[model samples]
Target: MKSNNEKNPGISRRTFLYSLGALALSGCDGGISAPVTPGSRATSRVSTSGITLAHVANGAADVATSGAFAHPGLLHTQADFDRMAQKVAAQASPWYDCWNVLIANSHARLSWSPRPQVEVDRGGSGAQNYPVLYGDIAAAYASALRWKITGDTAYADKAVQIMNAWSSTLQILGGDSNVDLAAGIYGYEFANAGEIMRGYSGWAAADFAAFQTMMRDIFYPINVDFLNRHNNTDITHYWANWDLCNMASIMAIGVLCDDHTLFDQAVNYYIDGAGNGAIAQAVYYMHPGYLGQWQETGRDQGHNTLGIALGGAICEMAWNQGIDLYGYDNNRFLAGAEYVAKSNLVQADGTYLTVPYVSYTNVDVTQPGFSTASQGTIRPCWALVYNHYVNRKGLAAPWSTKFALAIQPEGGGGNYGTASGGFDQLGYGTLTCTRDAVTPATAPSGLTAFPSAGQVVLSWWGVAGGTSYNVKRASSSGGSYTTVASGIADPLTYTDNPSAGTWYYVVSAQTATGESSNSAEVVAVTALQLHTYLTFDEASGTSAADATGNGHTGTLIGGATRAAGHSRNAVSLDGSSGYVSLPGNVVADISDFTIAAWVFWNGGNAWARIFDFGAGTGRYLFLTPKSSSGLMRFAITTNGGHGERAINGNVALPTGQWAHVAVTLSGTTATLYLNGNVIGGSTDMVFAPWRVGPAAQNWIGRSQYSGDPYFHGSIDDFRIYRGAMSTDQITALVQGS
Candidate 1:
């Protein structure tokens, strides 16, 4: 194996060993080498035009070198590198365990299983190989970098042995021409070797160049050609493509080797196609494989994890090349990392749950067929290690720290229980946190009330730990309360604006941690009670049936047209027929209520009219032509109140079409019905109140003030309510109809 630290020509292994021993004897600091200042050649800015791209390359190098920054690595300090190395070191034992499973399974020919071919099994059972190599190479380089920083011979020797074994295998595999066989046997192994060597110093320029050439000239072309030839665009399953991992691995190597063309093409294809956004789109278009799978099972876990990881890698590559194809800020890789951390690592209990599938979908209801223990351990181990690296490099958020702490096993067996691959006693010894309780700092001594300017104001002491407050108000002593304002996190005061009524108000406090408790209810009142006024007949004594007063009433007569001089009388309160018309038009007060009435036709071909303007003021309520059915309508123009309903059962009125009709308005909702059944209803509306004046006049068997759809019917028993009447009330009114 090549030593990255030696000065080539004169530095022998013995001299190198002696120098390191001397440094160790001197008790020199061994954690991290001091970071070079900006002016230093090793740390100088690569290029201003493509700063983003340069930073990405630097990030890749940092990842490759166990987070070191002696030369190619940038955007991280010595402390950052040391922290990353420490995390990688801690995972060495676990990596060994997991990798041994792959090594055993691979040697046992499990990779050659025929039931599910290798390509299809790559994610399912064959996933072990790649993760193992990735872990090994990462651990090796990280350990070597640690030794470089600390003058530790043991670390250096171990790194060299690992590298020697890794490099020998790479050389043997690179010599093979059977591309499929080579990749199947050692594809991940090659990626791992290339990644580790990427962090090595340029002093071994010849060996590095040779290794780079082999990867580019042989491995890359063979794999790229194989992938392109076998491309299966029809497969909707994301991981089914053999090139997903291969493309990522090749891109990483190509970027490091400065193969610009390969790098560009890799980026274009992956980001524009197999990248993060692409996977999300695919998932949206194609529902999860298992029905309600997201709710029940963890089947989608592997795809989500792989897509996110690959997305992060591609983003890093694009960032390093100064190409923001995704249109986000220059920190595309960091964005991907944050997204993965938030979606996968963090849990509702404020602890990191290891199952990525659990975070992707609601799973408490649908347990996946796989062993819960496997789901828990595998996901958490992968996520925490990845997150630990991201956090140490300062690429993650503060919230990720909580996730890291949660996934660690309480007594050291691992975070998701005993790690025995069973769910019998899961979540035991886990650290979980819940929303904090809240308590008011001050209690109210007495409730205060005030009424002024048609609005009520109430004030109270501020409560501690409350992020929001809710206020409710009601009319009458024990009426139901209505919400005035909620989730208002402000000074402890509220105001109530109600229509014409005295009301009581109450408040509740809510906290940032989602805790809410009611505060003492307060009382308040407004000065004036506003009333709706109804205008009827103007007080005039007799028969002129004043054509210029605000109220008037009458009966309909004559067929098609009124008899020339046979005057019809307006019925009075005492039922007298002495031309007893009110002086003005009739107006009914219905602040929030239902109105019902009946009309009877006298011999007339014209439809009977119920509501009519004194003059032709463009407002009237009457039935259409008899051939057009006994349909009746009500129209008012004070504020544009309009409603219509018709009898549609084929029930004809005697001679002329005269029938019963009703219109109801209840809090923005209005209904129109004929006889008894409702025909149509309108929601979210306001029927303007009607007004009558002294100049208004009423007419019998004709429009009170105009021509055409005139009433040839007798009108009687018109009533109104001050509030909304129930269906039963309307039903009884219909019986009278």
Candidate 2:
């Protein structure tokens, strides 16, 4: 009976949607409309949406059976498994190897031995031999998939017999402290078997109903309560994988029962409620100058990769329901995959690159500087992450892609690592998800940067399979560099105006698959006066106090909160309405000026502002997004009024990921640089001396327009200079010089 707003902040936004279940079940005398046909697509998937058995069952019946179907349905449909089997039969490259391992291990499971009165009891310690029951569930589902693919009714009959025995005889499921774990992991697999078999015309309707009853009674409650309350722990208290598994369980049950409310609950929890369920919070941002860091970065790669796999399973279920969790939050999940893959990589020198090892309680688990460790345990976990990021998103995932390739010929879970005992059988990806062929773009080599009086020119050797190039720079060779330019196609050279300092640069190729590795390092130097800088390092409070000691502080407005930055703390602006207001006249009188900052944008159709400073009607300088394209647009009204000459970048700023943006004005010219390369500018521009209203009208994440132009993004390391910066100086600034 709790209203959505009445619940604690810990409660998620999806609560309101799911809470309408009661009203939905009881159709109003004069209702808006009947629930949209389940199998047919709805105009919109709002709270009022409803799905039927036909909708959830469509996956199992689809003529061209594919993976990533609705819940309750098997992970791979009939056609999907058939293709895998065909590949196995032909002794294909990767599929046959995985199939060989699976067939070898699953020979004994061909016969069904259903334990109807199975009671897996873990002592109070929450550890037990429940894998036996879960193992049976895995076997049943695997057998059912084989039956559908091969048209072997014996496999189908065995799968049916297994479900029938459990439904007719199983009376109770308890005795384990971690009984919820059993319900979550085992229950979903069982439900999926029932879902696939439900499509079999031979399976008695009565028996299928009985199985559905069993799932609803024995598994649904446990899984739902666990996800909602986390075993009476804090809502966000459980381990990431535990929460993910339970979410998967609920989603499966929801699909099996044709309950859109329950399905929505799982989606909402993953996206909003469970803190660890979100990609941003679940995996910590990579430190500004370091590689991307996952929440479990300090943990072992086994557990970390397991988290990605389970989470992917949940998202896959959501995807079947027409949600795109895989692409959500700027594809934040990719960072975790890359982080784990990079950590587990074997270097040419035979050493492993790893982060510090920490325990579940955040305690250091290894000696100082010896925290780096690699399990080198391979499992069938790579496909889910790989198919989504590399194949679907078209983003580079070099480490993960390589790891997925190395683990090709993947077998069942018990063959390695913590996934022993039939936990994560993954032989399907090689057959179902593997690309026919992938020719990755080669990395650009021999990058060089030269500094001139007002410009820095960067050139690199081009390679094949590349549609464009990405330019990155850092102040020091060891510092983490930010992308200065992206989508620079052809002519392999770029020019920029920057301030003075030591600068390091690199170039990378980008193709349809992903980005290539950074080319060889190159350095450049320039001379420009360093000016006001604000790192926004404080983790809490309302002030973005200036780190440059120029005393130009910013006040956080509305609900602006601190968020992860390139290297430290930055302010996050709610897309609708939140920003940081700076004092007027802070840098008002400058004739020539350069401004730069690192930004992480959450895209919207609206014009999202980065920085806005100007009079409502007169001379103004503002940076905002252009509608449709959402590319970075910098404009200045030197003569006042609505007429404005703006430089709009050809390449849209990369959302979710951080990039450096700088704009400098010297004489009558204003040039904008993304990362460090010049993207857009004009030569025939009139100079406008700086001026501002006495009121604090200038802001980050908001504009001084009639309707608020609030930015839904994060900004950090903001710097402003009294004079225009040379191209090399801008490169140095972007490189953290």
Clash number by candidate, in order:
25, 21
lDDT by residue (tens digit), candidate 2, 1-737: 01111112222222322222212222111101011101111112233323322322221111111123453333544445566767767888776665556555552156647665645543344435566666667667667766765677887888888888888877556753366666766776677677778788778989988888888888888777766566564333444666666677777777777766667666655543433444433554422111335554454456566666666677666655555556443344655666677677667787776543322222112212222434554556677667655565444555677778766656552553223324643334565565443443357643445443345566554444467888887877745988888888644667755566666777788776878888767655454544567788897999888776767788899968998888778888887778887765444334457889999887765566788765343335777755446577887652233335567787788877888999887655788899899988876344333312112256788776666457888988888765577789899888863
Ten contiguous residues minimizing lDDT sum, candidate 1: 31-40
The 10-residue segment of model 2 with minimum total lDDT is 29-38
Cα misplacement distance, residue 144 of candidate 1 (Å) = 3.2
lDDT (Cα, tens digit) per residue for candidate 1, span 403-442: 4454443211112322332111111111111111233333
What are the lDDT figures for the candidates, one per model? Answer: 0.35, 0.59
How close is every model to the real structure, measured as TM-score? 0.34, 0.53
What TM-score should be assigned to candidate 1? 0.34
Whose TM-score is greatest here? Answer: 2
